[model samples]
Target: MSIMSGFCQISPAGLCVYSNEQTSSITGYSSEEMLGMGWVKAIHPEDRHRVVAKWKKCNANRDTLGTSFRLLRKDGEVVWVIGQIAPFLAEDHRVLGYIATLSDVTGRKKAEKALQLSAERFSKAFNASPSMMAIYRLADDRFVDANNSLLEAAGYSRAEFVGRTVTDLPFWVEEKTRNSITGLLQGKEAVHNLEGRFLTKTGEVRIGLVSAEVIELNSEPCMFVAINDITEQKRAEAAIEVERRRLFTVLHNLPANIALVEQDYSVRFANNYFCESFGESSGKYCYEALYGRKTPCEACRIDKIFQERVSCKWEQVHNGRPYQLYGYPIHDIDGTPLALTMSIDISELKQLKEEMLRLDRLNLIGEMAAGIGHEIRNPMTTVRGFLQFLGAKKACAGYKDFFDLMIEELDRANAIITEYLSLAKNKNIELKEQNLNFIVKSLFPIIQADAMLADKYVALVLGDIPALPLDEKEIRQLILNLARNGLEAMVPGGTLTIRTYNDADKVVLEVQDKGQGIAPDALKKLGTPFFTTKDKGTGLGLAVCYSIATRHKAKIEVKTDSGGSIFVVQFQRKSPVAPQMN
Candidate 1:
């Protein structure tokens, strides 16, 4: 009776009744051969028993039989079918044949299985979602079908929420939400997420950001909304704004020339006083802006600090007006150099610094020359007389050994003079951009060898180093001298630490030695030439370091006691590059 109807003729045993032509083609048998075959033989193997039982039940009752089962084709593959079989009778109501209607059920069965699997995957995704979410009805009201996060927060069972309107929830503030919805329905446009408030089940007010869009669910009108909690973020932003304004107000009252430079060192912000102090129309470089020139002036103290990774102080002529300046780099949150700068005009202080330097340099040179002159000259005169006497005499018994010892003393005197000259005289350092840390790393192995000879252990505690204009050769020499000193200071099996890093506004290099640390008096005399505390020692190493540091405008700081000696070199950034002479 269905629109999709077909008929079949079967015996009471449920087998296809075909004409002679069809029987031979389908069964690979002639009509006579099929007539003797059992109807169950043509039925699918798995369905054969069930089909046979249904046939017997229908025949005994003389009623219609309906069932869906699989039948075997001539090729032995199963084909799904739905069938209605009824008894065919003669006038005496005796069964003669069977009539049946059938339709293929294979496609329908496959589709039903596919639909079931799709539903299972959707269910899993909905339940396992981390975000608070749900399906909603657009026509009736904003109704939540399910939400695990909501259930946990609201303490509501699924049955309590499903088929229930969000408006009826007392915490939702129905009046406000309905007004917004009415506006959306009138416009028929999507509403972006906006901040709103909600009342919790326990009646506590909470903030939320929400947005909704029109959608089709099951071929009907609906809406899908996503909500997020942002109460803390809102509070933090307001507090930050208030603090920022307060700080800005105070910063505008600074007395010195301070400017906020961009990452590229360009003048992004300059105060009214800074503009009055240093005019505009300067080049991009910070030095060019302050000094009004393409190249840095000679004896650039700031440049030396940055270049040599040390501190320096000096006075320079800007347009013939000497400005005693001290400048250093600013560091950002991650300790990277920033373009921010603070400078003060110390022109009046220039005369005081020059006088101090002159007195200090003279006093240093005078004390050093006086202390060594007597001992050095006395020893040399004795060694010279012994050598002259030895040369005057012929080689006698033990004379050669005595002569050798005298010559060794002579060589020691000469070595002292050479070291003193190197220490006091300022050799051209050839300041250029260099990695101080690289110089340290490259010379570490040589330092280790020196330590081995001294029977001491060395430790390298390397830190951060930023690239700058420096002389690799000079820094290498400086590091070599310090490391050698560290080894000599340490007793047998003592440790040494060589560390490098940027210390705030300065590039810092420190050499720490665990040994019989220098005495306070010895430490004070460190930068004076020929002030050695060791036997057979030329005490010009630290003096030469001080000379090199001054020439490069770098600073040498010492921390020494019995525990150990730590020599820290700090360099200021924003110093100009020194020119190379051919």
Candidate 2:
């Protein structure tokens, strides 16, 4: 036999008869010590009984046997050996003895054990990982294994995905993504942080960062993919972007000057209006940008905001323009404090408030004038009657002319008082349903006569309109007053237009004059008592017109251009009846 193989001959009773030099070399035993020892004694103590029973069975049957067992070496080391035993025969076909050959296989067994341990460790790590992980066969993209995280993320059970291919599962949001991944894998590319979209079992698309590499699993080429779901992170980023755009739009389009300032009074951000007005004054003091001062203003509200953590407001004037300033404290996501300031132009509002005060004063004066007129009319009537009685007496012939003149002056004074009394606050109004066009037509003759006296023309353009609740006498007075005013404002050949029309839900009575427009100053005071442009006029005409319009719940609007002026009185188509006089 070859010297490399350990050869031994045993009696049919399973005792060792002879042993080769290779036996001592393989088992670390001397030839003298192993010659008479039973072959079972060379077997490892843990495997001796099983080998002895198998050897006895083979001897009795006179059959050949092949098996592997461990041997206890003389050095106390265990060695794996593969053994083949056979029964030797004589020429007469009778069994002689058993011969066996043994080969060492310790290194191969150790290598197999190491591979099994490595596979177990890999399985534990893959399943215990937090990331979604899966192993798919590269040949057909079939899922071979998946971790618990992967199953949960995909909203699928292990049974649903273990035997399915990528195409069988609704994993990819777009088919193109699958094709791209396949091509990259085929090219032996390592996918690192590749962003892709995936679909869950519930048909939800999730954004994921995927990493994959080609690996050998169970001796077959496969892909090991790791996915990190970033769907929530991506959505949060998108919403933040939208909010940023919205904030920028609001800041850019705001009519007021808005700015963000730091605690040091340095401007951090400024809107477009602020930048345009302050000449790109970021990083400068607020007073320096707004008032051209070197230091902060005495009215700085930023200090108050930082101290109280609340909003503050004040008014200031810059370059003769009024401004209302406001300040607020804001905190960032990290709790860093910031100051927001806004300045709005209030110059027009200021002027309007002053104008309202003046109007209020005028209304008070008008009320006083009405009360005084009521007292003066009674004595004036008695004085005018006595003057008429004295002028008719024969005994006062010398002073007859003086008496007549006094009575005439008294009557003129009474007429002026009557016009003033018309502006009283508590005038009784009797509102009833009346045709506006019919009212205009009834007053047309008077309007025409007034226009003819001034060598002007009167045109009545009446339209079919709905009946409105109005006091008939007051409406006639308003038409006559407006028509006469129009006629007086026109030139000799100019036209005075009286037009009645239905506009929207109201009836409009328009009186237009083809004369030079009123002066801006006089136009503003049109309804003030005793305010008029005519030399001999008491401004009570337009004032009375406005008062009557107020009592009837109508609006009076005047439009004047360089060519002419138009006064429009719009009355509601349906209005409640006004209270009658007691």
Candidate 3:
């Protein structure tokens, strides 16, 4: 007997009388030990009674019987086996003993059990999954199985779905979709995310992404398809895309520079102003692209915003003009941090603020001067007259020089008071259609005389200009004060040039002096009362000039550099409706 199968002989009592080596190996019992031993003892307890009953039945009938049962080995292991028992008979056909054979089916049994387990798992998973799934018989393309998700999504009962073909249900809204999927299955190809429209039992069309693969079901080729319903997702995505485009349009046209920056200091998006100011910066570091720097700027605030998770505002000067920058922290839907940075030019705004403050100070000083001018000067006048009257007497003749100096000092004080009063916002002014060149010429002699005394040369350049409303007296004072300041700013032999010209709808008078440029700090405070740049200067000259210019609706603009400084007063060519008065 082959060792793969166990063989044994049993007597009428069903006790093993002889056995092959295979039987000893299969039962882990030697032939001598198994002799006279009941063969039923080797059968597992759970299968013993049934197997013994069958063995006795076969012996009584004197026929062969086959059965499968578990055997308990001496090693304490259970082995499955299928065995055949043949009854040995005498000439009268009376059963005497039996011959038995057994083949081990343990490996095949384990394999079958594993297959059953896998099928059970697949069924549970297929039914429990939320994804819509269906199996179709490849031979006829008929639905063999469908999960609950598919039945609910398609509005179909299991009875209505299982036996129907794709065409019978008319499921796919497009014929091409059906043909394509069928073709893929026939060609042994898997379909992945083939988007198509399909109809429900209610005739409603729904969008779905179909993915399928060929699988074996019940020993026959079948198509297993999984569909993902994306109708709402697609619609939401479309709406989000539309909103994104609308926001892009709004930002792109904004007047200020706007940019979206990532944590890596890279520019994610830039508006028109940003792109035009810094060139194309997408996918590049912000500092390197916007400012042409190899590293981040020392004063950069963007990094601080990211690290601290806050917004910020600051002012900076770019190319000699003031700019205000604002930073706001933002996050994406996934919670990625980003920054929205905006920069706006504030040069004109800053200048306007400064001008307002300066005018406020001038008005305050002017009011003080107008309120107390005569009251203070009257006593000084009376003292001067008494001093002169006393000096002419013989008793006070020795103090005549002192008396003259006192009277001169008083006159200087009175002159300062007059200049201060001129700064009053409502100071009276006579406005007439007058030629600026004529006024400049009339004052040229006095300006030249003063320049000569200061050992400075003076030159005049007059251009053809339209006549403008002017207060000749105040115009003369404005010219003299500016010319004297110019003459004082230079050393001996330095030249001062005064010029008048026409500048589109306005008349311009410019005083040019070859002096070192004014310092930036001092330049800002130029028009405020008592704000002086000179050691012996009263500082009211320029203040009064600004006031006079305001009364005439003119603008004072200054341009200065290391080479020289120029003070320009431009008068609008329109006449005032009436002379201004206080």
- Model 1's alpha-carbon lDDT is 0.66
> Which lDDT tens digits does candidate 2 get at residues 99-193?
98989889988998899898889889999988899999988889999999989988999999898999888898888766776778888798888
Give the runs in model 3 whose Cα sits over 4 Å from its true position.
11-17, 36-42, 48-63, 74-76, 87-97, 134-144, 154-156, 159-250, 253-255, 360-364, 383-412, 425-521, 531-537, 548-557, 561-582
Clashing pairs in 2: none
Q: How many residue pairs clash in each candidate?
A: 15, 0, 0
lDDT of 3 at 203: 94
What is the Å distance of residue 472 in model 2 from its true position? 3.3
- Best-fitting candidate, measured by lDDT? 3
For residue 238, give model 2's deviation from the true position in Å. 12
Specify the poorest-scoring 10-residue window by lDDT in model 1. 18-27
- Which residue pairs in candidate 3 collide? none
Clashes of 2: 0
Candidates 1 and 3, the one with greater lDDT: 3
Q: Candidate 1 on 1-582: residue-level lDDT in tens?
A: 554555446674545564344334434456555554555676677887898798789788888878877766667656667767789988988888887665667688778768788777866776766545566786777565666865655566778767777678654544676468547856887766666676666776666676667767778877766557666677776787677556545544676665554444455455555667777622365556777666655765444444554544566666645655555555433354534445566754653465346336634664565456556767777877777677666665457677777778687867666455444433445667777777777888889888888788878777767776676766776787888888887779898899878777788889998877788666656665567887966667677676666656677777787798899887776555699999
Better of 1 and 2 by TM-score: 2
Count of backbone collisions within predicted model 3: 0
* C-alpha root-mean-square deviation, each candidate: 23.5, 11.9, 6.6
Index of the highest-TM-score prediction: 3
